[model samples]
Target: MMKEGGCRPRAASPLKWLTQRPTRVTRAWCSGPASPAPADLWSTLKKALFIIGSSTIVFVALRNSLTYHLQHFWGASGDFWQHQWDKILHTYGDNPFTFMVYGTTIVSYVVYWTVGLLYTFVDMTGYPAILKRYKIQPGTNEPVETWKLIKCILWVNFNQIFVGVPFSMACFYLLRLRGWDESRQLPTFHWVIIELIICILMEEIGFYYSHRLFHHRMLYKHFHKMHHEWQSPISITAIYAHPLEHALSNMMPVFLGPLLMGSHVATIWLWVSLALLSTLNAHSGYHLPFFPSPEAHDFHHLKFNQCYGVLGVLDLLHGTDDKFRASKCFSRHLMMLSLVPPREAYPDVLPKGKVIRGKQCYDQPSEDSQ
Candidate 1:
């Protein structure tokens, strides 16, 4: 304690160490699950079951999503998925998010499938029944044909698949030859887990800014408007953005990997999961007890230029959340007004509103699940 460098020791502080080694323990722990923790077996079972169930729900929706450009692009395994999975089985790590148990690729598939079907219904007769039933606040009243909307959706997602798939495969092959992806299949699970977490952090930063850019007034009028078509009424229109916007938004995860570290399959899987979940949920349009809903995004669509992040934090940090604050404040005021007389616990009426242009407010909507 009395040493000259005692206050400024070379040894790192615990927090610093943990921060540096995010996978510190996970890597060590997964070497082999040989030493069983003495915790109740039932408890571990419950936790495992919970994780599996949650991952399944997300995957189911994502898996059902593939009806865009190719009605029969792959072949006769069953659908395109059969062909895709066959490829994945033959090349496990090579098959996109196969390595990621709750992979984003699957989730994206769900998102596309769900939206495609929804638009299909509305397109045949031009009725957004789904949107009308659940949407919080109404955005544009433009009549979007179902088939037309599908085409837009296809163009956007396909942009990523066409470009990013090849892009990733190229990167993967290059990284492998350089002997990068080869050594990490069994990285201390801890490091793998840590790397996953780090990838999330990095992607969050990348996505937040990228999402906000599309909201810029100039950009909004161009391709972005295509997406915000059905605000209150949930529409397949979520990913129906102009191809440029879609390309940029969907590829945030891909862009982040190299900036922070070498390209790794683990990183890709983790990134895919986060992106798919956030994107799909953002547009899932279903309000849940635990998570934010499409209405959360309905708010943004009604009043663009706010609500930016996948989860909604960046806006708060960057002094951009005033729109959300002011809207919530007014809505709360409206609730108070609707109250005073009866005070019966009010029903939630604040989903979205008629579209309105305004100052950039709300730090940024967390489009994480959008």
Candidate 2:
């Protein structure tokens, strides 16, 4: 069981702390080789097909209806965008590689730090009573020292600057050599939508398999353990990982789809921005009103396993999310519609006698209260 502050007892020495094995409690929650048999292949495949089919149908329907309108809008604003593009190309020596490198880097950091700092502020202050009540793992953030947060920030920046940029440069060079286009013309809305859908699917597959692989006994300690240090993660912790894990699991999956498709620099920029925002929200640890619940990923951190995929489809297929599916957090996964605390908004999921705002909700509560 986790201690009061949701942390394990610290080792006497820093080296020991770094090298210590997971406790029995942690092992129990992990989806190692000893876990129960996964769902039958046929059934899992059927579910996957159903999900894909339904999503495709919905997207096609929307595309059919909205494509023309979107195309019209783009056509209307074509000149403005064309001028902007020309200015960018002219200023950047007409080099798509330079444009992509600078543009994506700026956009990614802007979105990451802008949203990350907001969530960090919330964690630090626990302000705006409504947001505080929605804290998934109450009291976990309380013990995080300011120095530790600074270290996390510094490490994340170091990885991005030294590791991420070079990887991106190399990938872009390979892609160009592979005949990837650097067309000056903007892509149609229809093609952009199609490419984005493909990218999302590819990312899901790549991330699911790679993440599960990293959790293997031999690899976890070396490559992925650093990331799990934040069981109750804040937004910035989304990229706080070992450099190898960052390159393989975090960066590779995202770039895989775009690279294969030979996507335009602008499209890549947009995709990276959206992907960064999605991750920031997932790791933000708040189920704020009007936003998708971060409960799935939050539970992943707390338990050290399960909910291993972004869209949950792969987890459902491999039976990795069986425990998560049975948990109260699953029921509470919908986007929240109110500013009220989760304890109030999702009373059914809250254990009886669990304290919320200093009051017990029921007379008898489960010992393992969230």
Candidate 3:
């Protein structure tokens, strides 16, 4: 079976502490059979129009709703100041049940559905035939496993059960017994300060590793592939994952936090907030002016099978980042990706594997491609 293998040299560190160079992957494997297109990118104009338009509507609506609700609850917009207890040194009395339970359920739902409808709307409209564009995802003509999909969705959404709930209740109620009941110290060190930091650190590292492993060929088909079902039209539907992946991907922030004794209410707020917004933006498929676009992960969805770390740092560090120097997933926007010729595009590693069957013949037709 024909195969491809190569490794490019690592560039200088974008981050400060550089003790080791990243080990890059430069091989494409083809399944025993054929697959569809080489790539899965949408038109610049259409992709821009669709994902961006939907985001604006959702952003505005969600912001407005959140504001309206917060005002209804606290007589003003919900921000750090909302937690102020009339005195500067007073505690932040936030209801964990509200934010952790009601708040998340509400936000992920609204934000998710907005994204979902947007994608569906785009698909229904005469948009650039995105699904078929790059043969972007070789979703099986095999009937969608409806039962399995539903099971996965329910299990995936219960992430907080494992991550947020037990840990928050047990550690805060049992180990620390520190609830934000009025006299909660105003953003100062809590009873479980060390655990909070440790939990977040471990979880972040765990998230990074699990994410990378999901891209491994064996795991991708069984678990991670469902998330990539729609290429250019990334929306809220993108959040759900395999029930099996629930332990790995979903409840991480919660479970790891507790194990590390992260039992504070405020710290939990910050982490949860970031998790919500970040996950929404992950499917945005384009970057914001002040933030990395949805394209960061969108790039992952396209010519997938490589580049699996978050915030572009770990992936960049380990040389797993295939966006620029290694893989051609960004072939759709070579102009944006190309800084110079790839002298080591396919450095010889003498890789051993079957022909990366489907990928080579899968990309869109263009002057630069084979």
Candidate 4:
């Protein structure tokens, strides 16, 4: 080597040679390619299945024990309801559909106003620091005007009376045509559970598809745009929508499951109450302790295109929740375990670097910016 060029090539050092390898190869080895979407989806699905299965087993076990202990109480309650139903039937000329319409309307009013007004009060007043800390999206309720609130209240009531009454009648008749037995005695706990599960599944499927359909460009302006008026909805805003959307997307999904199952009138009443409570909670704008987190639906309200389904199963399957899953809110998305503010309650989950205000999460700026 020295004879040819009048210089000797330095002996290659193994460590130096290794260090000089292609940077790309080294980087690639250290940080592998991102996991494929399908693998991530499968993992999500597995987690969901495990949670659902475990919950179902626990629910069944608890229901069995509770039903056995409360059999006499249930019997007494059923009898009391039957006596009340007799009076209602007599007053309404034995029209079960009329009873159903009246019952449903009354239940809706009670649940809506009781829960909705409490939330509205908080929205306007922002009092009782106890409840304020759990406020999922801050600053949303602060700027809402009183007249706008009143307008929403009036329109919601009007919808319940006009659109809701007719729709209830139609649903009752449809169930009748399908041979639903309105005169059946109070349903057994087992039958109620089975019917409820079916109803929930049907409602989830119907709501997801119909809700997504309403978001279509051709349909949204005329049918569903009103519902989206409240980007950060309060409890009362759950049913606030165009009459058409309320009928097809909101009411129909809740009714479809019961209709298909031919559930008893008593069971239907129970279902209606539970469904109303669930929706109110979702739209309440507060993520209180011991309640299901409203984050998913809240995110839907904020983003508009994601989390279209109630339980998120459909959204997950369809990848509509991809953005939601990536969000900071998702990291703090567990049910509130303590009464304290989420920041204090779950310090580990929501580290101090960022804060959630309204629909946005960002790093804390200086006090002047605040």
Candidate 5:
């Protein structure tokens, strides 16, 4: 609120200063509320630190154990290359059951826990305080119910392990049956990059249309409504949705890209992991510096009709975010323009004032001019 090199005199009473923003009930109706204080934030951070420490220890142990098992299975014998070819590529890759188990286990842990734990850490570490400190729009000041948050975590884990993994293996097996497996050429870094770009394009286009469909009057009330319940969502809420919506709107887009591209299995896994991280970041709730801000998607959850796409290109073309762009949520950062010094901002102009005023200097006849 402060202008460049300018200050307002304090209000006479402490109550006047406290009542300046809005009453609690009134603020609940509008998007973008105040943040918590530093002391409250510090308390939350201690809990987050403990969770993070424990998770790290568990993850390290899991990684070491998996590595030892994988090495024993594939590399312990004299011929490492032969063992990898026979057991991993030939046996695991070709068989649907083996592939599904391997895919689900690895993907469930890497993508699910990576995004889930990070979300938990940020949410616990006072993301609301961060949002408030930055004056970001539609900030989530209140806490979510612990039981509901835990339920979201469990559902997402289940979706990844049971639905997502099995579906992926089925797609692969179908492709193999159709001789698509023949095109699974050895992937170089360049091809992998190209595949990733193609995957993003495919996903953006697919998700844009599919997501818009979910916003339809009839569909929204049934399937997509569950996800919209959380306007200011935490990270796990990215994947938390009705099962039908999760499969059709969420998983299908990701699966389609790799299938269309005939990507190697490793490439598909890599893409999915990165895509999960992208979605998680988009729903992270915090406006942390150097991180992707979830303002657009968050606006969608609050406004309920705009910003349906991931990349937002389709939204821009369709003018979906027009109302959102005009709202306080989108314009909060623009308020910082008031902080730019007029002198430096207008370097070509010369001042000819007898006295300086707030944010402006008026031209006046000086002694030299007379």
Candidate 6:
């Protein structure tokens, strides 16, 4: 058998084998034989509960502390809540609501922008290598252009702080002026949680329909196509869209539940902040194990007309993700690997597309296809 050419079958390298069989490791780490077993689901739920619970606790404590300091600073010595209100009334008189709206807007901006900056710093500095390693399926790793990023930021701010907030405040003041709300008691923690859940459900429903509509040929070009410019997106890309799209799809869904519930102002602030954080986390390209993966949503961005929901529940029910599943890229195993920098980034691995769906890759023929 020691015949002609000593061409023996080469042993597969460990890296090659892992790349070929990435799902094997993912299944062992995050699931069972079935797709995301009960244990896996429970683990994700527990993590979310812990984060929300812990953050709420810290936020309440800090707010109380700050209020106390502010009251003392103003030389007020009386009931805490009464003292703060009295001070605001004394200072702003008939325009207290104006000040309240301005304060909330400014505070929300500070929180949202602070979180955005931190994520940017982390990805740009310490974790660039880490981001590359675990990036979902191979795609572009190059940074988005500064001008494009600026456009996204400016448009988002214009919609959120300028248009959305003032419109919301006007509606709220009108409702109060008309004496529509009846229940005027301090809200309990249970009420906040319930309202938060309602808000999420509303977002899931509203965003699902609005997103699907935006993908239609008639509306896509005018309203939502600009957001599709980035096939592989970063965290800041979450709010990057036309102003009307932001209003219809992003802001309205989030605020609808709170508005209907007449939720406590504190609960509204907390829920809005959390929703912003959630969206930012979703658009963030990294797929850390402890955190929920952005693979599904990111896949939607990479491959249009699929997974068009705030959460995947609606998509699953409607079979919107079937094509994504068939692509072999939507596996949980690949999502878990999304945290690691790829062995090689896109272009080296495979060609990109204007839109990629299952076996077919399509080019942007017109503005609508973008």
Every model's TM-score: 0.51, 0.81, 0.48, 0.80, 0.61, 0.63
Model 3, 128-211: lDDT tens digits are: 443322222223212234564455346445654453344344444432443333335434432334454566556656666787
CA lDDT for candidate 4: 0.76
lDDT for every model? 0.48, 0.76, 0.46, 0.76, 0.62, 0.63
lDDT by residue for model 5 over 247-280, one digit each (tens)? 7889888877777877666676678888888787
Ranking by TM-score: 2, 4, 6, 5, 1, 3
Instruction: Give a tens-digit lDDT track for model 1, residues 1-370.
Output: 3324222222355543211212223333444442422343444456546765896688656653543222344334334444454565566555433443234445555655665565445434536444333223323323445566657567656754665455455555455555455333323333454566566667667777777777666677886777766554334555566666755775644446543555455455545655555555566433333443443465566566556665444554443444565443223222122212111222332226733222222232235723
lDDT of 2: 0.76
What clash pairs does model 6 have? Answer: 132-341, 132-342, 133-340, 133-341, 133-342, 134-338, 134-339, 134-340, 134-341
- The predicted structure with the larger lDDT, 1 or 3, is 1
lDDT of candidate 6 at residue 120, scale 0 to 100: 61
The 10-residue segment of model 2 with minimum total lDDT is 356-365
Runs with alpha carbons beyond 4 Å of true place in candidate 5: 1-97, 125-142, 181-186, 331-370
Where's the lowest-lDDT run of ten residues in candidate 4?
Answer: 17-26
- By TM-score, is 1 or 5 better? 5
Q: Which wins on lDDT, candidate 1 or candidate 6?
A: 6
Better of 3 and 5 by TM-score: 5
CA lDDT, candidate 5, residue 168: 64
lDDT of 3 at 117: 52
State the local distance difference test value for candidate 3.
0.46
